[model samples]
Target: MPYLLTGAQGQAGRRLLSYVVSLPLPNTDAQLLAAVLAIRAARGGVGNVTGTDLSTLRLEDARAAAAALRGLGWQIDGVLFDGDPTAAVAVTIPDLARETGHPLPVGEKLRSRVSGWVARTLTAKPVKKLPPAARLAGLFLAAHGTCDSAGQIPADLPEACRAALPDLLAKGFLAELSQDRYRLDEAVRHLSGVRPPTGGQATRPGAVPSSWPQFNADAWARWKSEATPALRRHVEAVEHCALCALPVDRVAQAFMVAPRPMVIAKATMGAYGKWKGLHPDRGSLAAEFTVAFRAEHGHGPSYYQLTSGLGWGLDRSLGAYVVTRLVKNEWLVTTGAVPWTLRPGPAAQAQGIALPKARTEAPGDVPAAV
Candidate 1:
């Protein structure tokens, strides 16, 4: 299967195209070519995407940039990020042998924190039906597309729209890929329900009430009351590794281990190619962590995420983050319910196993937007 790329007209898009073009295609390996195919496939996934307003970006300028890349043998496969599948978990690289194919290259916008409260809020049942934005904050850390770099969202929204998911979902503005997902669908912006926020409305941590933030200031105070005043709550926020600064060696391992089971995915610089999810115990994560430690300049350490970070749309706040352990065995990443893969054949998952698929949708169905 060819690589599928999505969001061809956003910040990462043009830059990615430019970078790929700069590379000498012929000398590239088969695996490299497969990665390109995966990117192309992502482009094909797009449908009724709400084109970013790009207030100052002239259409002609974009065309010129696109044309220049076209001259460089850059071929986009399909549309991706249909709505807001900010929850995608890995860099869909196919584990292809000489005979098999590879998966798409879906880079995640990594987040540093691991806690269980958030996952229950978004992925748990009885509440899985909650609106998409409830789980939106961390979308960027999960599966950011080209649009993420530009920070370009729909314009023409009211001044009060602190968060306007409803409006965007209405007029078929952005295709509703799934419950915890979204795709840009600007054609029906006017009909969208995402509205502006009103007076005194807080978008801060614990705003959702149903998820992790439920234990806001007062609750948080209660939980850590017994601990040292200074360390009342030190739910590891972020970390940096100095080893990454050195030239990387191929001897690398990835994993997920800790309080809970999570998909440990990180994009290391000069490390093992792209991102890899390592499971603890099941895998050699401790040593991997050591390597990660040695691979950095102790600055901008790779994001070692542990928590699943699912919940009501937002992934902001120190509490929302959870540290997790790497999986010790071979693992696969999924979206909603499917094992994200690069196999070109059928998407029909295993028989006894059923997963949620992105259903085509309209925006008005989204809560908060109205």
Candidate 2:
């Protein structure tokens, strides 16, 4: 069973599979690869795939899969089977590249996220050794299933996948399988595509209470009304982010409360010393990721989000130390301990990498970008 993902974690996977199933491709190994490749190319229409990626799929006919994609006007530079295993081959999809009518109109983060989901789902424990059709079927079932209820199989599910249902049931991927309906096993429920019900007791266990005594809505409104235009825009961006959908009290409380001084443990500093040596380019990479993240999300990434999205694999304490070091070195900046205010600092700007507002504002007014 794959580790459980949050509602936000599964969203991009659901959208990616939904888009691929809507296309004209048949249910075969080729279509399975297309789902992976298409999401990778969603942002810019060109994705890189190595021969190792092709071999890992255990496709019955790698050449046939590549040929089928070529038939759809996709460009595969060279034969996938003959290429050097480690070399990345650029695959271009015309439809995804277009400015208008892009089949998958997603941001850079979402494209990376969905692509990762597809890879992980395909190689999940229950289905990794199964045939390509069975693996693909598992993806459909997992994406459509809900944590609390059974789901009807999507109408767009491939005919090949339908035949592979028994394999999934036998492998413990499905807890229930009736005609036209199925439910994911408890272990794999985290991969469910459906958003859980909201607006009652919060769906997430141990969620912050929806109502915070410290938060006064009227006071918040008054504060915003009196704020400068730039500050107001920044506040509203965090408060009403479509992707975050944070509770009003949560948003208000973050802004109202003063941030406590950070206390770095000696162990965390030790870890950072070792980690930094292994990642000399961490500063530049972190800066670049923030620029792309801010363009997609109206605000900057949170500490946990920044590390995880970049695949830095840092624990909480170590991550804090690394970010602190980056700030001290002027590679990243934050707005007076405000959450999600991280952006490029002087070091990044000197290297010609900066946020839009950073480029436009005077040096002293850089904080206004938040």
Candidate 3:
């Protein structure tokens, strides 16, 4: 309930669920649930799931649900049933990996929000103990409903889900249920997928305010015109990134500013002392993530983006420390103080990990390979 979606976010979430339901996989509620989670977590067509995620579903047969996913050509590595319950298992869904015609084409932050929404809605008090069919039905209805609580059953609602409608109504998850029409109860309107009206003004979620001082279009254009080919390519990558879609001013400012030396605080070092113990393979993991991240986004990730994408769950200070350590160890590299330029360092390259050919070929006097 704490994860309310903005107008754009709601639409993106609805599109994601709709895309998965429309796939040719089995229409069972269990498979539907698993697919939603997998697709939401996926980046570059790969996502990680754990035994705990499966067990929390309380499905009649978790293995069977996973098997059903595999039937649709999803490659799920590792044994979900036999492994350590907390170990992350990577699930690769080929369709999501495509650069073009991507079914769920949202940015990383939006995807994470939708994934969190699915988890929270499924586990809400009214539906957590419900059967898989009923729970899945709840998800569809909530996603299709509006801020006003009105919704029509989707045309593609699975046959099994249709039979579970009465259970949702009985459980108070639905305020009313007629043949093809239904309304979500007031208690769960936050989970509605319908975009709320913004009084006619459209808003981009992360856009910079117009008052920002550094956004000079003429200056940016002039800088690009004067920049070296390598630097120009790097600037374009940041400016044109589809995943970040950053404001022109924000992109311009980062490149316009001179690189600043990092000032490591005592607090950050203290946090790092405790944090490093939890991650034994931090160097390799950080290095590998940068490669995958650049392949999809066309630019390197910032410190926070790198840690979050890897599911390291570090706060800003600790994340900085970790990245600093990786840089020191030669497992990751950056372009001085440039934003979003974290890539594999020499150590990783020595281990057969490096940037794509196009990226590696263009190296300017930036003191790093992005």
Model 3 lDDT per residue over 107-156, tens place: 56667877888887889888989888788888788777775645679886
Question: Whole-model lDDT, candidate 1?
Answer: 0.24
Off by over 4 Å in 1: 1-40, 43-58, 61-63, 71-73, 76-219, 225-326, 330-370
The local lDDT score (0 to 100) that residue 216 gets in candidate 2 is 83
Rank all candidate structures by their lDDT, best first, as comma-separated numbers. 2, 3, 1
Question: Which window of ten consecutive residues has the lowest lDDT sum in model 3?
Answer: 197-206
Any runs in candidate 3 off by more than 4 Å, and if so which? 1-3, 198-370
**In candidate 1, how many Å is residue 363 off?**
50
lDDT of each: 0.24, 0.73, 0.71
> Can you write out model 2's per-residue Cα lDDT over 1-370, one digit (the tens) per residue?
4335443445446556666777666556887888878977876689999989988888888777777888889998775668688988888999888643344545465467567667777887788899989988888887667777888897778888898998898998888898899998886776665544456333532235666677787999998788666667778897776445567777777777786677898888888889889776667767766776576557887676566555566887788778888989998998876678888889978877788754354454425667
37: Cα error in model 2, Å: 0.6
Report the number of clashing residue pairs per model: 112, 0, 0
Candidate 2 structure lDDT: 0.73
lDDT (10s digit) by residue, model 1, range 1-370 = 1112211112122222233334433322211222233333332222121123111111224333333333444432222223233322222212211111111122222111111112322233322343333222222211222211212342221122215345444433345534444553433222111121123232112222222322245543344454333222111111111111111111011111112334333422212222222221212222222222221222111222211111112132221121111211212111111111111112112211112332433442211100
